[model samples]
Each structure stands twice: as structure tokens, then as C-alpha cells.
Target: MASKNCCVMFMIFTVAIVQAVSYDTELFETAPCDSNACFDALHGALGDCSCNVDTIDYFNNVKIFPRIQSLVSKDYFRFYKVNLKKECPFWADDSRCAMKYCHIKTCSKDSVPGYVDEHENERPAEKYTKIDQTACSTDEDHNPDLGYLNMTISAASQYEIAKWNAHDSALENFCECDDRDADAEYVDLSLNPERYTGYKGPSAHRIWRSIYQENCFRPKLNPYESFPYVLSSDLSNMCLEKRVFYRAISGLHSSINIHLCSNYLLSEKGVDFAAPPEGEWGPNLEEFQRRFDPSQTHNEGPNWLKNLYFVYLLEMRALSKAGPYLETEEYFTGNPTEDEETRAAISNMLSVIYSFPDHFNESAMFNGGSQAAKLKNEFREHFWNISRIMDCVGCDKCKLWGKLQTQGLGTALKILFSSQWDSLEADPEQGTLPVRHKANKRLQRTEIVALFNAFARLSNSIRQLENFRIMLSANKEPEVKRNVFEGGGANIRSTKEQCSSGGDKPRIWS
Candidate 1:
């Protein structure tokens, strides 16, 4: 027993030492780089670090794989998976080569010797593996402004959001075309725009229709137009590889939303270049841009995008908190028209379904039965997809409610699939069968409406939970009580503990 205890103690001691060393090494490597030391080390670093590890073909290697097609064709023909590895740490240096594997000096003063300790051969540079330099040039020329790439990204994002908002507003006006309009010199627009006008504008409608088709519909149908704006500077005069362009722009729009929210908070407080008014609510601009900017060395774009979305949720929480304190929080107000847009989309979809006989016949005549059949399949698949989503979400209450609502529709669908269509059409008004089928269709419609309501409620719940997680992460308080259910307060200290420890699994919709 004594010998066994001695062995156990020794094993524990060994494990502890190893863990301590590993933690120390990680801390040392991640330490902030000293500017002067890094400069000196990088300058004195002799030759290009050779890739000893086996390298696979990197499709984003622009030099080796030059662009042969135009930018339009490039979007269609582009083929490359996003490289999630950290960019080359020595991005500004000329000696760097585009490789999957290379070492980077950590630039820590203790790790890499300062000028005073340079002669002593005491400190050695740490080797950083998994540096992706697919965007780096093979030539000796290095863009001096490479360091300011993140800042450039932030500016470009702001520009894109502003442009998109203006474009969206213009499209809205075009969609609301009418002839009963006066000159724009001094027109007092009503708070609520009339849904219907008693006048028609065939010419104006035609012009707006053409513009909408060209701008919005065309972009949706095309590859190139839909491609996100790649982040490269006019100042740097650098051309990005196709993969780099795609990867960089993946989370850019989402990041742009974050930037706008951040700017709004700043503007509200009447201060510029300050921390978030909520106090470290989420990652700051620099940290956010660094984490999500695919151009950066340590880019965790996807993870950072998720984090930024959480930040958005937090911002929304702040907005809600501010609401009770005032009549309205002007800065981060919700879009009032979203519910209208949803209802409009659903109404338009239902109108199409109701008028399918005439529309399908016309489409069949013009574009063949295949086109009509494709659309029919799409509608059929949509219903099935909803069912699948409900199943996958594993929400028993939702599924139960769905079944209760669509029991008749389920029966009708069964008969439609099993029964001969020709026979059914021949017996047009077969007793109570037709009546039951109509009732089934009506019930299906009700189910769809219920599903929409459920989706909204569940979405709101998920957002609230995400906000709660963020709060738990930020707050040091041990116990926090939350009203998760109506008329019930739950002690969520365990949930908070789980979140703080990063052990909480992603929640499934109930």
C-alpha cells in the first residue's frame, strides 16, 4: 500500500509539472509582441524558413496558379476551400513565402532577445507552425501598409453598409411606384404610406420594373454580382487571390452590422473612439476586426462571427434595458417593417399557390412542363422541409401542436399520394371527400401560420438565451436568478457556472 501510494504521488507530480510547463509555454507564445524587439528580430532573421513538413497543393497560390479568366468568370470557376490557419506572422517581411507550414517569431522580449541581450545568445525565437501565407507574394516586395489592413477592412465595411441601406431604400420606393404623385419640391409624406393607390402608372411601373429586375433580381440570379466585395486597399495596390477574397468577405457583412451598432452607441454617447458604453459588452473594434478579419494572421473568422452575433444579441439586450428608462431608445431601434415584410412574403406566396392553375398553364406553355413540375416539386419539398425541421429541432410540444393542426392535411396528403389523380378529377364532387380535402387544405394553412408563430417565439427565446450566456460570461456574480418560464423563477447559477467554464453545450430548441 505504501509503495502504491508513493507511485500515485509521483505520477500526480509529473502530470502537474507537465501541465504547468505547457501553460507557461502557451502564455509565453501568446504574449504581446514588443515593437522594437520584433523589428530587430525580424530584420536580423537570416533566410526564409523552409517547410520541412509535407505541403499539399494550395489552390490560392496566385503566382503558381495565375488567373486566366475575367473577374466575372472567376466567380463561377473559382474552386478552393477556405484556409482557416493563421496568416503568416511575418506578413510585412520580404523573406516570407506562401506555405502551409512555417515558423514565426513570437516577438516576446524574454523569448526573443532585446538589443541589450542580443549578443548573449541566451534567448531563442519560438517557432510558430500552421501559418498560412497563401495571400503573400513570392516577390521581395512587401506592402508597407499591410499592418493597417484591418483598419481598411473596417472602413470598407462601413462604406458597404451605407451603400446597401441606400440601395434597399431606393428599391422600396421603386416597388411602391404610382402615378398620383406631385413634384418632389415640397411634398409632405404621410407617416403611414397608403397600401393601395387609386391611380396607375404603366410607364413608371415599367421603368421601375426594369430597374428592379436589373439590379435586385439579376444580382440574386447571377454569381459575380452576389459575390461579396473583397477587402484590398487602393493604397496597398495589392491583388488578392480568389480564395482570400472569398474567405475575407464571408463574415464581412455580419461584421459590418457590428460596426454600425458600435458606431451608433458611440454617436449616442456623443463620443468618438471610446469603449462601448455598456462596458466591455463584447469584443472592441480592434479585437473584433482582428478576430474576424480573414486577412489577419490569427483570424478565427467563423468563431468571431458567432461571437459578434452574440454581441449583437447583447446590444439588443441593452436596447431593451434602455427602453423602460425612456419612451424609446433611438439609437438601436428594431426595424418596424420586419413583421410587415414577413406577412407580405407569406401573402405573396399564398397568392401564387391559389393562382397556380393559370400561372402553371402559362409557364408550361412557355417554358415546358419541366419548369412547372420543378416549381411543384419545390412547393412539395418546402412542406417536407418544414416537417423535417420540426423533427430535427426535437421539440415535442411544437410537433404535437403541428400534428393537431395538420391531422386533416396529413390525411389529404396521404390520399393525394396514394389515389389516382385521374379518378379523383373524374369524381369532382365525390360525397364528403372533396369537403374533407378542402378542410384538410385549410388546416394545413393554419399549421403553416402556427409554425411561423412558433419560429418567431423560438427565435426570440434563443436570442434571449444567447444574451443570458453573454451576461453570465461578463458578470462575476455567483448567483443570478432568471425567469425562464412564465410565473416561475429558476436559479441559474449552475448554468452560469457552465457558461463561465465553457462547458455548456449548445442549446436545442424546446
Candidate 2:
């Protein structure tokens, strides 16, 4: 009886310990980046496994889709687990506070700095060593998505460029199957004036058109003729449809500007006039009081909102030029160069998406030139394509999609808008924060549901998890499969029954 009693006590204590042991997610809430050990214990490791464009490109082309099943529904958890481990240096992963996230005290236009090193009050930032990830090899059981996020972005870019050039013969030449294998001479980017013109800005497509008219369509067709990112339309038409291409570009840029998004959201310029605040006008604001009482200044919104606008301005200036980057051999030569034309073009186009708030700004696209609701539809079409790309890589928690759909755009929407702060603040009376509006709204919902949906038939169950793993292993998560059952219920009864269909079908992802 004495021995049994001791055993019973031990069992009780053991159970308590088990229950107390937290998931990586829980640890994120309790303690974030204060200690390096905290991130390690929760996120698994903290070696130099940072990601970049080349790596992302490689993964998208090879392994990203393969790791979706194992961790699909766990995006919220993953976000917590990989917060400091995966997202830091550029941003904070403070899992404890709801309001503080990906929160950087200050940011630089250059590479993001380590958080703890910059802020003594903050926790230790996770640092990675190196990863020996290859494009596609039958090697390990680790998340294949982890290995190729950048490649996925590149592939998506290729897909978008292809869609734009679908109508032209020369445009077709720019693809993999072109007659001269237009993709082959990409090494000569510097020499091709039409394709490689160093000029870049909002009018980049114009240069592309100039190239086509002079070379590609001019009689003999120089087999060597190349135009930077083939043009699908004239400059004005491209600008009109800029929202289409800009959607993806905006996503990519927002991803690059992740650290600044939260701040941008709080900016007065971030909000669309069509979408206003839920509250009534306040009286105590110093700026407001000053305006009404005299000898005072008009404070339209908070500093966060003002800062949000500045961030957008900075990002837009950079986004407008995303095109020349393709013209530089960098797109093909795999080098680095961002021309003014490309940036302007990218910015003008992307502004349609990120500048969604501006379109509705009771001010109406006066400066942005957008009409109410015109860009909104185009925004969804663009976002849908981008969603498919991320979906292929096992990412479904994307905030941009919800924003594009107006299905309650989340804080992630901040990433999709441009800085209209100047105009807002300029009003001296009217101001808003779409960035905060979107982010706060998104925070109200579960962050990981869609990530699970990204994987086909991933519901809550052992069978579902097992099926998911197999599909991810083969990079087949995005591929369509024939399920044993046909259409049955009106909606899904539960997550348990959504297990993936067995293999054998394939379709174009985007």
C-alpha cells in the first residue's frame, strides 16, 4: 500500500508536469525574444537559416509545396514558434502582447538589424548559422517549404510575366519554349537596349513598347532582340491595368517591407476614405483643440497614423521602381539592379492595390487617379493569383487576400496599401489609419485557419494529418486528387473528415 501510494503521487506529479509543459506557441506568449534560449526551446533551433530572394526562388521552384500538410493548420502556432526564430532581425516577434508584434523599435532601408542588440529592453534576437538546402533533392523529412520560399516568389513572377506576354510572338520568345530560346541569351542583358534599357520609373512599359516597335516587329526580327520583361500593352493601357501586375508586386514589396507594415497601418494615409473609423469625433485631441481654440495646431490623428503615412511614402517610392529590376540581368543574369522606371511602374501599378484605401478616400483618387470601386475588382484578381503562389508554398494565412476580397481585410492589409499619409495629413483636419484598421480587424480572427485550408482536405484528425504529410512529401499538396467520396453534405461537417484525396491528378496552380 505504501509503495502504491508513492507511485500514485509520482503519477499525479508526472501528469501535472505534462500538462504544464507548454507548446512552442504558449512559450511565445509567456516569453518572447528576451532570451536566446527561449526562442531555441520553442522554435527548435537558431542557427543561421535566414532566407533571401535567391533561396526563396529556389524553394518555390522546388520544395515549398511539399511541407504544407504537416504544418498547415498550425500557422498561428508556427507564427509564434518561428517568430523570433524565423521573422526577427527585421522585426520583433513579441508573442506576449496582442498589440505588439513584428514590432521593430526602428527600421533601416538596408538589411534589418537584430532586435535585442538594438533594444536593451527587448529580448535576445534569434540568429541563424547556415543551411545546406538544395533546389530539389530526395533527402530529408524537414519542411520542404522552408527550403524554397524565395523560389516560389520567382516562379510566381515568371508566371505573371508570362500571363502579361501571352499575346505576342516576341513575348512568347521570352519564355522557356521560345524559338530562339529567348531565355538563353539573358546573359546579354546589358547589350540589349530595348530589353535592357537602364532607364526605369513609372513609364517602364513604355520602354518595353519602344523596344518591340523598333526590333521585334521590325521586319527581320533580330533573333538576339530582347526587351526587358515583355510588354502586353502600351504605356497608358499598362498603367490602366497596372493594378493587375501591381497586386503581385505589392505583395512582394509588402513582404519585403514587413517590418514597416504595422507602423504603416497606423498612418492616416493608410486608410481608405470609403472606410472610416467606427467611433465618433473626439474633442480632447490637442491638434483638434488647437484648431478650434486658436494658438493650437490641428492634430488629425495619432503619431502612429502619421508614421504609417510616412512609411507608405517610403515604400511607394521604392515600389514604383520594381520593373527595372527585371530589365537588369538580375531577372535573368541573377544580378542586382533596381532602375527608376521599373520602380515607378511597379509603384504606379501596386498603388492600385495598396492604395485601396485611397480610392475610397472621400477625397477620391484625385492624386492616385483611381476611381471608386474600379481598382477594387482588379485588386482581387491580382490578389487571387498571388494567393495561389503562396498557397503552393503552404502559406494561406496571407492577410492580403482578405483585404483584396474586402472579406474583412486584416492587419495584413497594411502590407497591401501605399502611403497616402501626405494627402491625409495635408488635410490638417481629416486623417485615418487603414494599416491599423486592417491589422486590428485581422487580429480579431484566428490567424491559422486559412493556412490549413491551403492544404487540400486537411481537417482535424490522424488520417488527415497522415494524408497531409504524404502529399507534402511529394510536393503534391497543391495538386488536385480524386477523393473516394463525391459531393455529399452542404458544408463540411467537421475538420476530421476533410482528409486529402489520394494522389494522381495535377492542374495549373494559378
Candidate 3:
């Protein structure tokens, strides 16, 4: 009897050990790393991309970040044309952000550059002629007789110039948003930055939930399954195109969260907004940990951080591929001096980006057997749908950025996988220039501005991660506040009433 009991006990212990091992394995495969481990292990090659994450972090942090920041601050990149009033098509809810910070200040018509506002047909040829004439007049050595040679050109030449200035309508198929809407207004992105907007709860959650559930091809998992388990299983079997699509969205989401954390409104006490101008804004260490620390976020933080690097490489690859076109493309904004400076700045930035050793290979993607074309089209359509979904974002500032970044990613996809390459190559004369130059006239000015600014935003997020890491290591939690508003309870009561009515709690801004 004793011997039989021992045998049964041993068998039970063995089954329990097996189950424990399986659980551990699943956790490792899904989460992969903790905060410290992620920072240390961020060196390897990223999924499906040729570049190393460590290399990206180093170059972007040290060499490229400052330049890109400066580039985006320029006139040509600062003003963005977007239809902020577009209604949400997904749901009937038209909720707006209650926070004052969520509002975006639109540029007055007179504030926008004249050249940017000019129609293609009315581009004013004299502007180009004046620039050329000014340069010739300033030159020390020039033939007196050939001086100021006829500023006028033939009709054919004028037509060619106008064609060059006009945006390629075909690229619109890649992006779903109607950027040319007559109702669209110019918003100075410099004035309105992406940050903590007290925009959360059911409304904000619905936007992301819909995006992930509807767009990403993630399978429905068991209700009892852990998030890590679901994440691991879904990514394990997905094809390259699907994974790229998923990662791109995840990366963008991660970038936005990082921005909010970096620029959180920590205190409203005693702080005088009128005196200092800007509100009390700085990094919220506790918020960062809550969102990204593995211990706090159930091991999902590292995956999101990794996806952010993937997006940086993806956009970097696009910029590298389009180097030839970007180098020669004009950044005219009605000011000749600033335009020349813009060109030189872009040229220098491209040179530094081109120095990177390995880049994401655009050609390796979409090579899946006969279904390749179908998969490519599906990928484009899915992204197009995402671009449209941006219109549904309730917060004005959030929608502005959501549209810009999605459009930027869509532009990157077009550069990577579009069939326009074949048409460009078919012409012998066009083929004489490098293949990279094929994007010269294909991309719109808005798309170009969106692309570079979006990458700058991602780059800033990556750089800010270090600041967050240091803050985390300090291990100090901020003191609890009685209220977010000044004068404690009285102001808090009024603020709550302004945000909502009837006794429903207002969404807290951390």
C-alpha cells in the first residue's frame, strides 16, 4: 500500500512540473524582456528589417535627432493642412476633449506662406524667374551681354515647370484622407504639440480597440487566455505583410504614448500660466512606468518599445530610398533664402542617414508566392482604412496628429511597395537617373512634410526613453495631489463640472 501511494504521488508531481514549464515558456516567448533587459538586449536585428535596433538608437540619438528637430521647425515643415472638422464615420458619438490642452490653434489665412497657398495654375512664374535673375545678378563673374537673359520661357517650358510643381494624383490611392478639401485649414504644428491631453476612457479606448480588432488580422483567442499568450500566438503565425502592418500601428501607438509621458502636466498648484506662458509640463515618471514598466503593464511594455524602433527603421528606409529625389527637390515657401537653407539642411541630413550600415530591405517584402499581389493590395487597403479611421478621433489635436502620422506611414508604404517603380523604369530617359529619383514628382509636398515630421516625432520618443529609464531607476514616486487644479477642492469642483455633468467622474489627467 505504501509503495503504491509513493508511485501515485510521484506521477502527480511530474504533471505539475510539466504544466509549470509550459507556462514559463509561454511567458518568455510573449514578453521576451523586462525594462532593464530590454534596454540591454535592444541590440539585435529587429523583426523582418535588416537594421539593428542598437545602431538605430545610437545614430538617431547622437547624430540625426537634433538635425531632424531643426528641419521640422522650419517654415516648410511647420504648417500642416488638415481637415480638422471631418466627422467621425465609425460611430455617432461626437465627444470632444474637455482639457484646454487638447485644442489646436489654426493658422490664419494671412499667416500661411503665399507660395504654399497658390494654386498649381497660378504658381507665379515670376517668382522662379526672379530667383534665377537675382542669383545671376549677384555673381561676380558673368557675361555683361548675356546678363539677365530673357526671364520669359516658351509655353512648353512653362507647362513642364507646372507639371513639376503639381502633385501626383495617383499617389492619392495610397492615402485615403482628402487633403485637398476646400475646408481644410493650415495648423501650425509647432504651436500645438502632441502630449498628455486628458483624452482617455471609453472614447479613446474605442478608437484603438476598433483599429486593432478590425484592421490587424489578429485571431480571436480564448476568453481566459492571458494578453501575452494572445500576443505571442497571433504574431507567431502571421505572414510578413500582416506583421509589418501590425507593427507599424503598434509603433505609432507607442510613439504617441511616449510623447504624452514626456510632456505630462504634473502640477497645477500655485503655478501661474499667465506669468510663465506655458503650463507646468514635464516628464511623469510614474505615468511612464504605469504604461511601460513590465512589472506594472503585465510584460507588454518591451514589445511596444521594440515596435517603436521598427517604425523608425521603416521610415528611415523610406528616406534613404528617396535620397536622390529629396536632394534635388525644391522646398520653396515663397522665401528664396529660407528655401535654399531648407535644401541644404535636407541634403546634410540625408548624407548622415545614408551612412548607416544596414537598412530595411523593401524588396524582401511581398514575395509570398502567387498571392503576393493580393497580399500587397490587402496591405495597402488596410492602411488606407486606418488613414480614414483617423477622422473618427474626437480630440482635435489628437485627430490632427493621427491623420498626419498615418498619412506619413502610408507614404512610406507607397515608396516601398508601389508598382510605380516599373513605370518609371520603363522609360529609358527617366531610367538614366538613379532608381531612387523615381519619387521626385510622385510625392506631394504635404506627404513629404508629414513623412519627415513623423519620423522626427518617433526619434524624439526613442531619445526620451533614456530620460524615462533614468527616472525609473531613481525609484522615487511623486507625492499624491489633492486635486489637479489650483486652490485644491474648490477649483477641482468647478473643473469637474466643466468637464462633465450629473455626477459621472471626470477622466483624470496623470
Candidate 4:
């Protein structure tokens, strides 16, 4: 018993020592996703979102492998899987579900200085039966900026969202080709305006839901959209890969959101910028551009195009949050306009949701206002949209109640999306690509290390973003909050802390 205890203590000490030392990029070389090993680190860091197949080739032929590789490589681990274990943790020690080996062996170890740490023991997966192998070395060409590559992921998602949005917008735009509006915009995708015209334009609810749908399946292949945007494969084959990837991606997104937000607030130029004023809450506006021009500095994401797309993503997402959750059918079509009760419900819902903008500032509630508020708002609208559709299908509420319900639901979503900083922070991990925890036994420590490292990089990116916000807007000292404001927004409230007159703080309008 004494000897056994000593062994356990030694292992613990080893891990402790590993922790104290700076975790170098090389320390995780065994991380699987080689070429994009940092991405490999992301999976483990975020949680688990690994392979389910007994072997990777279970369903993949050479062509399929490369295709899946591209999808996996370009898309990251935000896909679904069937090989997921019955339990959450592989080492859970449940006799009934104990891990069974699934043949994913590595042949040789690298010899570079830190490529493989001095070996303690090795496994047949390597060539030795001992446990510790040299620590993996850092890739000489590791690019820290790879963390910012999230925009590429975002672009993939946006492209997916845009296709659907464009489709809906097309239909709506086409519908407006009526004689009463011949001069009105037609279904020209080219004329896709950055701003909504209140009277016409794509529905924000639809856009948000569409993005959520992609996000949901971002790691998992939706049997619907197969590749660049659609899933051409059968659900069975797709689900396994889809689920696996979705888990990882969502987790990654969460980390990225947090890291960026925190960094933005702390950066030199970040806090120097401010949420300008009314009609200028991070929207594409000339006034907003002018407000920061004099004090503008570099070291932030510069391109106007990039900023524009991000703004659109935020607005659409926020608007989506502002919507009432409607029935499946209502998700596409407007909910019943027939019953007064349903109508009232929709109206009330909308009113309540639009009210969130007034409550937030630089305090702790910022993220709640920026991200969460919108999410809750979207859920509320989803409820309304579904309720009305259900109402038409013979489940109508009392006339007054239905209308109030509809209105109330819409109100909630609007308020929810209007200023969403806090709520989004709550489950940022859930939406990231690689989700935490899974059932696969074959997926092991090395991959997890890779994934975890990726997540750390993402976390670092967010920190950078947070830093940016503090410096630019002069938000005093910075706190490490999720969702950096390196992205833009016009402040609606004054912080209790006074700023030098005309600093980045928004000057509240009378």
C-alpha cells in the first residue's frame, strides 16, 4: 500500500511540475491535427468533440478522406458523430461502459529538442510499452495569428447564413416586385444593403435562426446543407461527423468570444473608442465612422468591409434574438395574422424585448447586454413565432391573450437582442466548434491537448480584444470579460466613472 501511494504521489507531482512550467507550444506536439495542430489543441481545450469511428477510415475512402479532411480541416471539428461513447468521460471507470481500444496508433516520435520530451515510458501506440514519451515540440512555423483565423470560420458560417438569408431575402424582395412597388428593390443579391429599411429587408429573426442552425450543425453536418453550405450526404453518415465537429466548433466559438471581448477592453485603442449614440450602435453609419476618425489608431481589425460584415452579423443575430419563437412552420412564414389574441401576443413580446438597450454600461452587465440579451430575445421570438403558427393550426389563444402573447414575445426578443453582452457569455462554450465532453474512447490525450491548446489561443485572442477595448475607449482598468468590444458599438449609457470631457465614453444625448 505504501509503494502504491508513493507511485500515485509521484504522478501527481509530475503533473504539478508540468503545470508550473510555461506550457510551450512544443509540449503538445503529439496533438493529432498536425498541419493545423493548433486547431487540434482547440478540441481538447474546449472540452471534447472527437472521433467516434473505431477507425477514421471506417467510412472514408481516399477521395472521401481528403474531402472529409478539407471539410474537417477548413471547417474544423464542428461536426456530428455516431461513434460517441455512451458515457461523457472516457476514463469514467463505469464497468458497463469501460473504454475499449479502437486502433489509432502513432508510429514514430520526433527527435527535435522539445519535439518529444525526454521519455519516461512509452506505449505500443508508439513502440515502447512504457507510459511517458517525450513532450511534443512546438512547430517551428507556429503562427499565433492563427487564432484570429476565427473570422474565416465566421465567414464560413456567414456564407451559410447568407445563402439562406439571401434565399429568404430573394423571396421577400421578389414578392415586392409587385406593381405597387416596381421601383422598389428586386431580388438582386448585388444590391444587398447593409442596413434594414424597417419597411422591407430580410427578417432578422430568420437570419439569426439561420445562423444558429448552422452553428448548431457547424460541428455536425446537417443532412441539409452538406458542404460549403449544404449537406448532400445521408443523415446517418453525416450525423456522426456532424455531431463530432459541432461539439468542437461551438466550444471554440465560446472561447473565442470570451477571449476577444476581454482583450478588446484592455487594448490600447480599444477603450479609446466608444459606443457613439442613438442610431449608431455598431451599425454601418457615416456618423459612427466620423466619431472615431480623429482619435483612430491601428492595431485593430481595419478593413471597412470586415467591419461591415461583422456589424451585419451582430445586427442580424440581435434581431433574431428579438423575434418570438414560433412554430416550425411559422419559422418560415409569418405567424397567424388572423386572431387578435395571437397578434397581441406578438406585439407584446416584441415590445418587451426591445427594451434591453437602456440597461447596460461598462459594468459587469456589459456582456449580458451585448450577447445574452439577444439570445434570450431570439428564444422569446421563436416562442411567439411558433405560438402564432400553432394558433392557426387550431391552438389559438384567447384573442386578447394571444395578441398580448405575441406582442410580449416579440418585445422580449427585441429587448433581448437590442443590447446583448451578458447573456451570450453564459454559454459561449456551447456554440464553440469543439464541445466539451464526449463518449469516444479512441480519441485520446494527445488530441485533447491539441484542442485545448487551440482553445487557449482563442482565449488569448479574446484577451487581446478586451485589452483593445480598454485602451481605445478609456474604460479605466480592464476586466477579462468574454466577448471583446474590439468589435464596435455605440454606448447608450454613461459609466458611473467620469471620463475626461469628450473621451471615448458616449456622451448621453438629452
Which candidate number maximizes TM-score? 3
Q: State residue 393's C-alpha deviation in candidate 4, in Å.
A: 46
Q: Please, what are the lDDT tens digits per residue for candidate 2 over residues 1-510? A: 999999999999986655433211111122111111211111221111122223222322233223333322221211110111122121222222122211212122132111111123221111111232345765777577776554333445556555554433221111111112212111110111000011122222221222223212111222212212222222123332332232223222222121111111222222356433421111111111111111110111121122222223323222222212212211111112322333333334333323322222212222345552444433333333332222111111112221111111211222234231122322122222222233222221121222222111111111221232243344322222222211000010110010011111111221
- Which is the winner by TM-score between candidate 1 and candidate 4? 1
* RMSD after CA superposition, every candidate: 34.3, 31.2, 12.9, 32.5
Global CA lDDT of candidate 3, please?
0.65
Estimate TM-scores for all models: 0.19, 0.20, 0.73, 0.17
Question: Which has the greatest lDDT?
Answer: 3
* lDDT, residue 463, candidate 4: 32
Question: Model 4, range 252-279, lDDT digits (tens) per residue?
Answer: 2233222222322222223334632212
Give the alpha carbon lDDT tens digit for every residue of 179-250 in model 3: 557888889987887766677655665566556555665544423222322263356566776777777777
**Cα lDDT, model 4, residue 377:** 36
lDDT of 4 at 395: 10
Candidate 2 vs candidate 4: the TM-score winner is 2
Clashes of 3: 0
Candidate 4, residue 165: CA error in Å?
42
In order of listing, the candidates' clash counts read 1, 58, 0, 199
